[model samples]
Target: MSWWGKVAGGAFGFMLGGPLGALLGAVLGHSLDKGMKGMEGAEELGPGDRERVQTAFFTTVFSVMGRIAKADGQVSKDEIALAETVMREMDLNVEMRNTAINLFNQGKADDFPLDEVLDQFRRECHRRNTLIQMFIEIQIQAAYADGRMDGAEEQSLLHICRRLGVPEFAFRRLEKMIRAERHYAGAGRGRAAPPPSKPTLNDAYAILNVNADATDAEVKKAYRRLMSQHHPDKLVAKGLPEEMMKMATQKTHEIRQAYEQVKSARGI
Candidate 1:
């Protein structure tokens, strides 16, 4: 059975015991454990469990996303649409989609345990740095869903980064990359797509996180590194769900466009 099967069937509950399990159990409308609801100490999860990690990834992502959306004290229509768009892109089935929606709503609650969830999530995927980065990227994209990062939203994101051990500098680069993706897709300024030149040389540079002055070799190196990190095959092997291949491919596609633009500009 797939990880989702195990998770949805509640077969994976024990290994995910703690807030994550409790969260999933809650959204699934089944009690994983009476004790799980108030459980903390997700620190006990180790990095060696691949099935466990995959289960945790799907569970934490939607829930934390809700937390971020509510950071500004309200969830916008666009923000809700953005979450739905992700669900569509992933091609989730009816049951899975409903669970994801419940998780998102769960995240918006007043007493959501953001820190405990992050701590456990970090540990579950400790060996998969790229996987963790992918999760952060999703959150950043959501924060930018309405085409602007609200002040409270930024603060919420930064706190997420700190809890996940992501540095401020790294967060800055990830933000630029997500913005570049919007430009590459001709998403003029918001979720609404508008036709434009689509990713000027400057946006291309931002996508790759390199400046125009960088050596051609450096540019190529960055491209290769990003492609390798975001590659769907590699990510799946590292514990990402196969359902996420479309999302991962989009990321690599954007990077490729950025790299080609940079190369073309330099006459490489």
Candidate 2:
């Protein structure tokens, strides 16, 4: 069966036991219980398992995003727009879009179980660091939607990283890359006129999480590691949702651009 079908068929029967499952059950209502009987023997981490993980990822992403949005006790218009932008980027169909919206709303609820949801999501990822990292990046993007990561949002992000087993240094590196990307993208859009010099060189190094004076071999290693981590096909096989492949694709593009820029500058 298709991933979506698997997710729909087993989401309730399989997930109804957990906090996230309870939220989904509430949102999906009677429909979630319709196929509970047929969802047996679908627990292996094969294709069906991948679908299940992907579904979990999708659900956890928006829900946690909502939680982060509400961390400041007020969800800004920019944050809402960012959620909408993600929906649009994923190009979710009506049913899936509605599901995402519901999940997001559930996340914003005062009683949302952030720790429980993160624990479940971490288990779903099966120790796949790349997937966890990607999850963090998405949250960071949403946190910065209002042009800065507020104090509450930063605290929330730190908690999330700790739950996901991401180191503080790694999170800092990601933050730098995110900031650089926003700057680079803004420049590309002509949002403001450029100064005499471009920020490409510095931004490139930041994207790679390497210092400007890093050795050639170190730069190559970072590039290769990032490429492997963000490779869309690899991530998909490891349970990244098809709908979210765009994120992996864009990440790879940024890494490639950074590597190219570094190579040109260093005469490599």
Candidate 3:
């Protein structure tokens, strides 16, 4: 599978990792049960449950991407073309791509119930932040796919950055590093090794943008404020290119998880 396929598949695995993580794992025996059924491992799928999962997965993933692409003021043909390339690279049939595009368009529309879709996705996927982040990273890659990223795209992604409980400055710094490396590779420049430790919990407080000794209220406030920025619907409204909704879902999960972690750690 391609890197994009791995990401999508990982999203499902992460989803099952939440509440149903344990049971599903023992039943399926595999981390990602893309084609596997419940414990019995039947080839046949009950139409309703399968359809529901498919809808949730499709809605959430495309919605996130749509939100990212529109992060900038207007959607450009370049972005659209890049999206098509992604679809093609994934080997999604024309029908599947069309469906995805239609969903993407719906997500970008003014009145699409983004919050509702998110809610449904959360309910179905059980809201795993790791899964969400997988989606978000894909959108981030999409936005930076072309050599240059637009101001609107950056702003759009920043809004998502906030929602995911990710610090804008850190993400921007990471983005800068990613772009620089890509540039160097394009220009055949010598490359330096990256820091061994990518972003992790060691920077949790920084990711939350809170003081080490932040009060409970302060922590909640920061989490809420950060999440509000990455709210999937808000990103779409802000004209973030639609491709980054994947990031939005992950951000929402991250926000929730961060809030929980803070509450637990502070015994709030």
Candidate 4:
């Protein structure tokens, strides 16, 4: 059965006990089983509970998204629309979509425990840095959904990175890359494009997260590593939701485009 199947059947919270479990229970209108309350789960997900980390990821994404949307003191139409767009892109089922919306609302609450939630989520992933990086990227994407990030949103994003153990420079790099991606998506090859902001050699470097002075070989290594991390099939095998394949595929496209641009510029 899928993770949602187990969760909806009221069997998820017991095995996946943690802050995530509690959030899921509250959203579902029940108390998570306390058999493992206040205790830590295994560093690695075992065979029987392979769905546990996936559940953690889903719970964190929606709830943290809610808080990020409201970080600027008000939830704008653009932010809300981004949430809906993500749901639509994921092609979520009726049940899953409704649950995600509720989780978003929960995150927007003033009393949302941001630090605790991040701590538990990080633990749940058990040093799976690839998954953690994806989580941060999603939040950054949401914060700038309105085309610009307000000061409060930026601070909130930085705080999220601090709590999640992501570096400040890494966050800044992603910010630039996502901004570039905005134009890159619209400026398809041989199309009437926006200003020549994206696809700039600098932007390409940001997307690949490499220094301008890096050697050609280093650039190729970064490209390959990022592509591997965002590979749709591989991510799904590692417990990323099937509904998220669209996003994973989009990321790979971005990485590939950035790589091509770099290769052309360097005559690689």
Candidate 5:
């Protein structure tokens, strides 16, 4: 079973026993019985700390995504569609899909405890900066799903970055990269005409979080650091859920493309 299936099937309450636990109980309903027996021995052996981090990442991601969706006062059809698209992309099974939708709905509630959830997530991450950055990146992707980040959504993103100890400058840089990514992706689909000019040159630098004027050595250093930070094996060892590895993989692809673009442009 996938980690999410195990999470929903296992007696999460026995291990989590916190707001996240309560939330899972409400979301999973009576579906927990299917895998209960399998969990019995594992529970006696004690929950894996990695399991806790995985659960935390899964729970916090969907809930926080819903919160961001509602930041503009009303969740638009586009936003709803975006959520469904993400579910499809993740290839969630029926049970896990329902649970994810419930988590998203819970996040839209007026009483949703954003701060508490973030605090718990931060604790679970245990200062693993790469995981935290990936978390922020996913949130940013959700915010930009509608093709633009509205004022309310931008404010919510900034608030999230502040709470997560992510610098504002870094947040802005990621925002630019996401926008660039969307544009780049869109331009390649069934279009006979090309954009007046490719933005990849500038976007490449943004993706590496470097300046156009940076030296070749500086660019090389930035590329290596980003690649190291996003290495899937390293992140998985540090407790990134298996389901999220795809996103990390995609990130590395983007970084590599960006680096290649920069290297070509500079003849390096």
Candidate 6:
């Protein structure tokens, strides 16, 4: 089966509802197959297993997307209609359709704190960079579902992408797509510039606890400190759990990148 089918099937078996179960399943299933492979021989997973992971990943991402669609005060029927259109395009089955409804309902819940909801997704996404990218892609899809991408949706997606460590170049494509959709909607928009470097090299440096003018020694110190913090194993042990190690791994990548950038700029 396809990714959505696999996730919905695995999730439908749960009594607690599909979103939470699918999210957990997607994390564990992907973690077991992707990150933890070295524990044994690391053979590739079969197609069935891969399908399960993809579905889980897609469902989790869209579930969060559903939440974000409703974040700006009200969930318009137009948005709901758009969401269904995307689902149909993806060829989701009855169970998946029901699951998506449940997830959308979950997003509409009164106590739903979007940041925490996104945080949970961030951790799960941090476990796999590709999955993180996919999650953002789905959010963009949901934002464009209503035949236009609003500024509010774009801003929310930016925040989500930043928290999930989505690279700026990847997001640029999204910006273009959104702008194009806006124009098509007769919203009267200009082309989107490249996303600003709001959370890139500088943010990475901040994560390392260093300033722009730090001495080499200070930079090294910050690098080591962040290395310790960003270490995948350390993050896994510190309640981030191994399923979400992608975030830690991304942090480590950012730390190394920051060090290199600093070294290059300083002529060290």
lDDT of 4 by residue, 1-268 (tens): 8887887776664566656767787777644544345546533345424477778888899999999999989998777877887788788999889989999999999999889999988777777777888888888878867777789999999999899889999888778877777656653222222334545878788888898899999999999999999998877766677788898898899889989998998998
User: How many pairs of residues in model 4 come into backbone collision?
Assistant: 0
Look at candidate 5 and tell me the lDDT of residue 147: 64
Q: Write the per-residue lDDT of candidate 2 for residues 191-260, one digit (tens) a residue.
A: 2223123457899999888999999999999999989999999999887889888878878888888899
Residue pairs in clash, model 4: none
lDDT of each: 0.83, 0.79, 0.52, 0.80, 0.76, 0.52
Please, what are the lDDT tens digits per residue for candidate 6 over residues 1-268?
4344333344322211223443434333553233332333212223223333433454455567667677676776666765665555445557566656666666666664556556644443336554455456456756765555678877778877776777666686545533333322232211122223233445544544566777889889878865775576753343232333553464466557667766777789
State the lDDT of candidate 3 residue by residue for 154-182, as single tens digits: 77677665655557776764464344334
Candidate 5, residues 1-268, lDDT tens digits: the string is 5456567557443355456655676677665434343453332333337777778888888899999999999987666766776676566779778878999999999999898888777777888888888888878878866666899999999998888888999898788877666544453222222432455688889888899999999999999999999998888877787766776787788888889999999999
TM-score for all models, in order of appearance: 0.92, 0.88, 0.44, 0.86, 0.85, 0.48
**What pairs collide in candidate 6?**
3-55, 126-246, 126-247, 127-246
- Please tell me which model should have the higher lDDT, number 1 or number 2: 1
Which whole-number lDDT from 0 to 100 does residue 252 have in model 2?
A: 89
The stretch of ten residues in a row with the least summed lDDT in candidate 2 is 188-197
Q: Between prediction 2 and prediction 6, which has the larger lDDT? A: 2
Worst 10 residues of 3 by lDDT: 187-196
What are the per-residue Cα lDDT tens digits for candidate 1 across 87-162? 8888999998998899999999999999999998887787578998999999988887787888999999999999
**Could you tell which candidate, 3 or 5, scores higher by lDDT?**
5
Cα RMSD (angstroms) for every candidate in the order listed = 2.7, 3.6, 14.4, 4.1, 4.4, 12.7
